[model samples]
Target: MHRDQPPLRARSAPELVPSLFLDLDQMLDEFTRLPIRARFRFDPDMPAVITVEFLAERGPSLVWLLGRELLRRGVTAMSGTGDVRMWPTLPGGRPASWLLLESEEVEALFEVPTAELAEWLDATYRVVSAEAEMDGLNWDGFLMELLGGPAAASE
Candidate 1:
């Protein structure tokens, strides 16, 4: 077992949430029951970003790279702006979260289960703790390349 190989990294399990296809309408009364798959991932090296891939029955998948902290905070309260936004919602007496992705052409709303979101966040945090995120960044060499400094760049 002493082969001097790279250490095995823990990966956050991708969450497949069943979300209704809904448009950004004020009433929000109607929603197609057709479910879409949302794949979530947290790269340890890119600790600050949270990647989400929304897969639908038709058309191509949409990939979103958002702030991990923003998503975590959104779990409890409304967070984010512009292209992404999230907030807790209780529909049909069930606890869930609403994730809205907006673009100039179109927008989509997803009702994500709060429990599943919590679980996924927990797993991602376990894989790369908040404190370790700074250390995980490869900012040293890259910054040096940008600043033209010698070795040992981090403070």
Candidate 2:
């Protein structure tokens, strides 16, 4: 029997977008992308990333871990440089955002509804403000993990 079902940490309620079809123009040659499941999630543990997971019938689920701040600015205008970037679009009279994930090997583009993404970000802010995100982090522990060694923690 499970003693505790839900974890103690607060998770920002994920925003669900149904039938979030792609808005293609920049990359028409690429194959059509039909997003079966798409949502934005924020975990208190990983407060920096506003993760977006795209689940399709074929192949593994692709995920993009974008900055929470970047997404907030992206809804209204362009934000970010290299690696990741996003901007609002009005392709075929439908409102959407162009989410670009780039790497040296390959690059990908995703079109998400502007309103949906905006609402999700708003909901997350309601649960946890930006200033409060850094309150409980163990910086020394994080650095130790990065350096792969036992490092001293500072208060």
TM-score, each model?
0.65, 0.72
lDDT of 1 by residue, 1-155 (tens): 22233333445433532222222222243655436677676766667787777775689988888888877877789999989899887556556777888889877777776676677777777877877776744454555546754433433
Q: Candidate 2 residues 5-35, lDDT tens each? A: 2223444544432222332333434676644
Q: Which parts of model 1 have CA positions greater than 4 angstroms off?
A: 1-34, 140-155
- TM-score (C-alpha) between model 2 and the true structure: 0.72
Give residue 5's error in model 2 in angstroms. Answer: 24
Collision pairs in model 2: none
The positional error of residue 99 in candidate 2, measured at the CA in angstroms, is 0.6
Question: RMSD of candidate 1 to the true fold?
Answer: 7.6
